[model samples]
Target chain A: MNEPPRLGDLVFTPEEVQKRVKEVGRCISGDYVGKKPVLVVILRGAVYFAVDLTRELSIPFDIDFMSLSPFRPGLQRVEIEMDVDIPLAGKDVLIIEDIIDTGLTVNFLVRTLEKRFPRGIRVCSFLSCPARRIAEVHVHYFCFEIPDVYVVGYGLDFQGYFRNLTGVYTLYDPTGRSTQILKAMGKGGKR
Target chain B: MGDFSIITISREVESLGDEIALRLAKKLAFEIIDREGWVALLREWNTELPVEPPLEEKEQEEWMVTVRTFLREKAEKRGFILLGRGGQRILEGLDSAFHILVVAPIEIRIQRIAEKYNQDRATASRILAEQDMQRERFLMRNFGIDWKNPLYYNLVLNTSFYHIEEAYTLIIEAMRRATNKVPSVPVKQRSLFEEKNFLKERVFFSHPSEEDFARILDFYGIRWLYEPRTFPLVWDEEGNVVEAFAPDFYLPDFDLFIELTTQKQKLTWKKNKKVRRLKELYPDVKIKIIYARDYEHIVRKFGGRK
Candidate 1:
């Protein structure tokens, strides 16, 4: 068995996350003032951020969840593990994302939503690394712009662990923390 | 391949037909002939053909015919589970052949493509659309058949609603039934009876649980109307219906209605009251509520929610 990965440096404290979430919420509330927008939160990664952001918003809105697949061709096609139950046609939809890395998956999601003919669609990401983006995406709302690094915690995971952690941390030594976790779990290697 | 000879599985992108076919083949211990396998066979049959992809339009047409002919010959000798490569068209009239088409909505396919590539949904969707168009054209050029024509298939499965396991079992049952038919008689002799045309104006379910309910009805060979009729339980002062209940599924074969609710019991109290009134008003109607706890058990046992 492979060792579990570890976190390195604290990138965003829980307080920082809470603060940024409020700011984004305020901005969204102002932008879609009278409109009852559907907040489509990308699952797993953005779930924590989405919940906090929803609370910060004073305006009445509906909440929905979507889980997206990692992109690949052939056997691994882009798939939505879960879809929002609410009808999206002609509705204002705000996509909440945890992090925008390559901007590939997010771009795909936006296009997918567009086919449903929503009145308008905007993106709000908790974290983004513009330097590493391969696909072009315009994020309307963002919290922290961090450097390209392995980040985990607060719903982000290194091999499905550390998602329970309260704060965001970069894994400078990928092998270090993973090894320790694996040792504790009585295992070792990739994940 | 026990007794059933040839199985042709057609599918749209991201429908998970390939996975279901693989599992079915394994269960039956049949020789699987997927796209790559067909390509390999094509190479062995004639060294002149291009082994690499991106074949010219003319080459692709030629390849389809050659592969179809090859599969026909192979099926004549023994059984095989053929995946794609227009097997449905080629094996159409074969007595022992079973043709299945698996499909899901475009949105679901886009999501699957995105996940597989770990790429953006836009790129994944574009590729799927392109691939579908290519497949459509390929079939039209080669066999003059629409890829989605339900008439060409013995079974059309919506994998979006049916889990792989449920799908596999359905195929097994269908194949078993197919095998029991007289050897010389065509499987198409079986009455379609609300099969192909059933999808016209079909409702797109908002939840996987509802989809699963539909899948079960389909697996049992039952005809169902999705939220077809609304039953009014309360009326407004102006003689207008104030409250009504639309059950998730109405089974025509059994004359039964099914309501699937994953909502908490307390949350559904009002809805339950309306259903009770609906029952009282229409005493002939039979309704069943699949509550959250029972629904979870079904999901746990069947593995469809995944």
Candidate 2:
């Protein structure tokens, strides 16, 4: 059997990731000082980032998890596998995502949440992949802006692995295209 | 034809068409673009032409083009009611526009004119005749169309038979039904994965599962053709007979054929063998076999029952 590719050079170290998350958390705290925001973590990927980011917040907040599937039978819309238990009406909502690419899911989520009559809705993703964005969405807070490459670790995964790692890294690409991209970004050389 | 966007109101003088248009606009929260509104739009475009187009054919055609362009743009932006201005002829084939013509008996129209204008019966009859003649001549000269033709309108309302409120309500209901019906023709260049245009045709599925699968595909806005082609796998010695395989669905957007097998695992081997043979025969044709388990998993994920 062919061996699976190993992890490439680290894109963000544990220390660097924590520092950026803290900065973003502090910014959110400053902006929403008087109000308690509902932090909605998109499941199976954003769990780790949501936990770390929420821990850094100094204000009072409620946390909820949502799981969504892209397709639904007999309906041309995204299906919500799991909904938030808390009442979202008249509450400030902040969607926490591991990554934002294509922006279609975020846009759909925003529109879905808007029907709940929330005071306002915003997005906060750990990584923003603007190169892969096809839908227009405003990211209120993001920790890092990454290129369009196969990224893993820190709640992001490749084939359901490498998500438990504390820091983000690009997966080793057999075709070398990801390596070329990382090199262009001044990373993933020898280490 | 598409969404209920534009409404064109053509009415005989004092036929309650103006009242219907005004009330319908208010009820539907639509903008009523009457002669005043049209003049304002013309002024906004910096055109100093009269409210009516010139008698010359070329100038009138130019005016018609300008008016049509403005009407199309306005209709695309928002729902509005267009009053008069040869709207029926100007937007003859617009799928998003609904054309209405209002009429009443000559005696009723004369009575209305006399009542509304405080004129005598003879004067009212003379005024109605002159106005009707002027309108007929205007339409005939400008558009080369008979203004009173019922064929030009999707609906014709006689105010003598219905009150103003009843007239507008009926119009609103008709507009809704017209908009909901599938368009007889394609209106614009459709993008991939859009709502399928085969809504008007009744598709007969061999199995209920196939129908369910088609519904799921439609939910995702994936355009598909059912059993569009059959590939001959075996031919007779004389080349007159053959065995063939037809995939359940052909997704034109992806250029892929999907064969759905909802049978038990043991029974699916026959289909698998046929798919294998098809791949060997036509190496370039892309095909996928969605097994029963895979379909169940998809349904389960979406919280749907079998």
Which candidate's lDDT is highest?
A: 2
Name the lDDT value of residue B178 in candidate 1.
65
Tens digit of per-residue lDDT, candidate 1, span B14-75: 79988998898787767888878878877887778654322223444555556556667777
Candidate 1 displacement at residue A87 in angstroms: 1.2
Deviation in Å, model 2, residue B83 alpha carbon: 8.1
lDDT digits (tens) for residues A1-191 of candidate 1:
96655557666678777888888889888999899999999877788888888889989999999986542222223568799999999999999988886465677688689878899999999888774453458999999876534567777765566877777876545336534543454433322
Q: lDDT per residue, candidate 2, B102-170, as tens digits?
A: 999877888888888998776676567557655654554445444676866889999989998899878
| lDDT for B290 (candidate 2) | 71
Candidate 2 is scored at a TM of 0.46
Model 2: CAPRI class: incorrect
Best by TM-score: 2
Per residue, candidate 2 scores C-alpha lDDT tens digits across A11-114 of: 88888899999999999999999999999999878999999898899999999999886455446545788999999999999999988864656766886798
TM-score of each: 0.37, 0.46
Runs in model 1 deviating more than 4 A are A71-74, A174-191, B1-306
